[model samples]
Target: MNSFLTSGLIHAAFWVVVGLTFGGAVLAVFPRKIVYNVLGLIVCLSGVAGLFLYLGSFFLALMQLLIYVGAICVAIVFAIMLSPPLHLEVPKRRMGKVVLSAGASGVFFVAIAAVIWKTVWHPAAERGADWSIVTIGHLLLTRYDLVFELISLVLLVAIIGAILTTGFSRRLSS
Candidate 1:
């Protein structure tokens, strides 16, 4: 493929992924219903998986989909089902509290945006040309292997605890 067409295709893909990610984030934060907010989180996570793909990390993208959208979201769904009935309409907070929260979040956003915009990100002098999953696996296993094992252990414990908690709750309820 020609350089021009290839560059244009990459650019197009980047923008499409960016739009999906930010749009999903907007929906997640702005929605009134908790269910909609959860769905939005799932959508946003999927977009992040797309970004991982664009960054040439297919394994990370798959992990993001599996961990965030699949396991975490399904766990959240289960928790919601196990919880007491939700109010049909969420009660509004006090006007002052709402204003305070909004103002705090807006200020935080501005601060973060200003820092990011002002900081000039200089790329590494010599970036690696190899962006393969095999390299990632080898690197992680050789240099930073402990973290990988720890993460798996933590996930196993969390799954076991979730099951126990849900099971105990059911027995108590009965």
Candidate 2:
């Protein structure tokens, strides 16, 4: 009974996270206000982090929150605040552009769907029973080498941008 209940709860949580991710994505795209967009992005990122948690990757979930939600979203908020014209009027989007965007999105979706459908997914023949931190670290450093390097690069850029922005603000104030 306890196992069943736990399984049910996990399934429910997974759906909830998926809902949050899609809902936030919609909110982010459809909002006219910049602040609303940023907030929606944060929500979306948080949802993605939740999804990572649901996938049994605590490390990925933590990284998603730390790098995307913690750093990127916060930086965007700061940038928005620092910049003038918070309430700048947005120009009305043209019908032609909207139609073009929609068409492109549809094509991309179809292409991606086709690729996914065509691809044969194979799980590892011998699945490792061991789920250790050391194993994860080794895999990340070895197999996912490029991804780790890219993440580091992104972090470096964010730090540099923050430093430059702070110095520029101080100079402007003085």
Candidate 3:
């Protein structure tokens, strides 16, 4: 009975995360307000991190929270706060442009769906059984250290650039 209850809870949690992911994606794209879009992105990233946890990848989940939610989202929020607000009216969408974009998106979606449906997604033949956090950390620090450090450096530069740009804009306005 306990096991059944636990399984049921896990199943429900998975669906909830999935819903959050999809809902957030829609919210992010469809909203005209920049703040709402950022909030939606945060929610979506959080759902992705939760999904990583469900996949038994604690490191991935933690990294997702740290890198995307913690750093990137905070940076974006800072940018929004520092930048001047635009009171420009929303432009009316052109029907022809909208139709073209929609058709392109539909074609891309169909192509992707077909690829996914046709793919034989078997497990790797030599899949390592020992995928513990310790092993992963060791490998990351040893083999992928440069790539990891570069990513961090890039993020740092981006954040710095956003701050500088906003500061310069404020100065120009003043």
Candidate 4:
């Protein structure tokens, strides 16, 4: 009885997380205000992190929350706050442009979906049973040093760019 109840609860939680993810995605894209958009992105990323947890990849979930929800979303919010046009409304777009963009996106989506469906995904024949966090970290630092350094550089540049823009705006205003 207890096992059944636990399973049922887990299923319910999974649906809730999925709903939050899609709802947040809709909220992120549909909002006209920058603040709302940022908030929605945070919510969506949080939902994605929760979904990752459900998939049994605890490390990935933690990274998703840390890198995407915590770091990137906070940085985006900071950038929006630093900008002077917080109160300015977004300009309306023409219907033709909107339709063209939607059509292009649809085509891209279809092509990607076709590729995904056509691809034959096979797991590696030799599987290592060791899944320790420490090992993962060591591998990242040793084998993927260049990729890690690149990611860090990109993040640093983004932060610097945000700071420069804010400083420039402040100087102009003064």
* lDDT of predicted model 4: 0.84
Off by over 4 Å in 4: 86-138, 141-161
Where model 3 places Cα greater than 4 Å from the true spot, the runs are 86-134, 141-161
Top-lDDT structure, candidate number: 3
Q: Which ten residues in a row have the lowest lDDT in candidate 3?
A: 83-92
Q: Looking at model 2, report the run of 10 residues with the lowest lDDT sum.
A: 83-92
**Clashing residue pairs for model 1:** none
Instruction: Please provide, for model 1 over 45-163, each residue's C-alpha lDDT reduced to its tens digit, 9 standing for 90 to 100.
Output: 99999999999988889889977998788778666665644443334458997899999999999999999999988665457446477777677778778987787678768767877
TM-score for predicted model 1 compared with the true structure: 0.53
Against the true structure, candidate 2 reaches a TM-score of 0.54
Candidate 2 residue lDDT tens string, 1-174: 999999999999999999999988988899899899998999999999999888788888887898799878887887777654435443457899899999999999999999999998766545644557657767877989899889878877876786686666556554
User: Which portions of model 2 miss their true places by more than 4 Å?
Assistant: 86-174
* Models, CA RMSD each: 11.9, 11.4, 11.1, 10.5
Least lDDT summed over 10 consecutive residues: which range in candidate 4? 122-131
On a 0 to 100 scale, what is the lDDT of residue 49 in model 3?
A: 97
Q: TM-scores across all candidates?
A: 0.53, 0.54, 0.60, 0.61
* Rank order (by lDDT, best first): 3, 4, 2, 1
Task: Note the Cα lDDT for every prediction shown.
Answer: 0.81, 0.83, 0.87, 0.84
Encode model 4's per-residue lDDT on 1-174: one tens digit a residue: 999999999999999999999988988999898788888898899999999999997878988997898779888887877777655544457799899999999999999999999998766444644558756766777988899788878887888888897786667655
lDDT of 2: 0.83
